[model samples]
Target: MGIDLEKGGRIKKRNRTAPKSENPYLLLLVKLYRFLARRTNSSFNKTVLKRLYMSRNNQPPLGLGRLVKLSRKNADKIIVVVGKVLNDERLYHVPKMTVCCLKISDSARARIQKAGGEVLTFDQLALRSPKGSNCMLLRGPKHAREVYKHFAGVAVEGHVKPYVRNKERKLERARGRRPSRGFKRKPKKV
Candidate 1:
């Protein structure tokens, strides 16, 4: 489909300051919780919507865009998981907690190191880190299995490549209807 420009556009706030009087349903829930707390005369922990996982079938994860935004702001480390290898274009928009090997050239390595990053092999990345963890998993190639084993907890980023739209052909067809003037008309024979 179209380009996903919002992938790395914004960072998430660690502590969100929610509206005191928000959605009606949420308000009702809050009131109910408050009623319970008051009846018991003891405070209760509020409901929190944490991690939501998405299937890896032929579709991109739902709300993955939000996760990417969150990771950039809060994650300490990034690991890139690439099926085959990394490349120049991919590293341009490097998110935290990634394990990619597009190029893995000296310059790229240097740049990553300079940014205070930890370079790990695909296998090393697949090994799951501890819970309450903040990381991003980048799967670019078909060989994601080798690296998918390590990480126990991770936030997957990037949208799956959707079907391509042939815009150029559409434009060409549209242009054909217009008439073209000829400058090379032959002079009439006397």
Candidate 2:
């Protein structure tokens, strides 16, 4: 007699297409992009639609200074960002470039307008460039959040910060930290 073996069923794949946002305006934008993605052959619309479905953490805020620096060469093209744009006081001079984003800070808007740049909404951008032509899409640094500093399970090499209640000398200063308390880990050789 031949031995019989049981086979396992195939696991279902997780759906990564849906948006987690409940905001009406965001939903409207998603709807618009969905139609655009379907009707047009532009990969830009599809990319924008995918970004719209991302969480707030993934949609990191862009700084005006960085935006200016990046879009300096592409002055004629409109800058499209699926996240908020914040003003950077460090940037002494804001250049003239049209910007289109979900949200823009008052200071950043003022700065852009002062530099002869026009701020456009998503709807305006849709009407202007359905295929996303004459546009430069920009994104902020995703791993730049403070919470990322405390992430474990990686070879951070003492760079990962621990969650502490206080910064006082009496607090969190025990064994594994001080050699007097017990054995301390020696620094890695370069």
Candidate 3:
């Protein structure tokens, strides 16, 4: 009799090895990184290639202020971001450092240049460091979207925001919120 094979085995799904971007320039970068990843045996090149395959939404935008804060200790190393770099108006002072990204806002480009810092494209960065040497890879906060506010279960603690149709006097502002509505549970003691 043949051994049973259908119950315990399953095929593994493979992720995309190449980028989905239609731009020729991006495709060229992917091709270069693919070669580097295969030939150089550097984990950095592999990581960069994987990020290059991500969609625009998956690659969130990094803010200038946050980048400055995170890379404060390592000023000499180049900061590489696979997505856009946006300018934060709240940041008063811009630091002097080399930053490389796919796209940067006009204001951000001006600020970095004015602060004696150089902003480089991915192609330029590739020429400078093929194996990602002397570079720091950084990404934006992926869970910072507003949609995450309503992800928790209903009436759960931890300040999970509730989804209300509209903000009004008699909408979702009664019952558990106030003792006068009916009965209010005692606050949990720490």
C-alpha TM-scores of all predictions: 0.29, 0.84, 0.81
All candidates' lDDT scores?
0.37, 0.88, 0.86
For candidate 1, write residues 9-95 as lDDT tens digits: 344543323333345654443444344434543221121111011123311221223333445664665543322222353334544
Query: Which parts of model 1 are misplaced by more than 4 Å?
Result: 1-71, 84-103, 127-133, 139-175, 181-190
Model 2 lDDT tens row, 1-190: 5433322234355434668878999899999999999999999999999899989889999999899899888989999999999999999998888999999999999999999999999989999999999999999988788888888643256467878997665666777668887867677663
lDDT of 3 at 97: 92
Candidate 3, backbone clash total: 0
Alpha-carbon runs more than 4 Å astray in model 3: 1-14, 153-157, 185-190
RMSD vs true structure, all candidates: 19.1, 5.4, 4.5
Candidate 1 lowest-lDDT run of ten: 45-54
lDDT of 3: 0.86
Number of residue pairs clashing in candidate 1, backbone atoms closer than 3 angstroms, sequence gap of 3 or more or interchain: 23
For 118-168, candidate 3 gives per-residue lDDT tens digits of: 999888988899889999999998767777667764323645677789856
Preferred candidate (lDDT higher): 2 or 3: 2
The candidate, 1 or 2, that scores higher on TM-score is 2
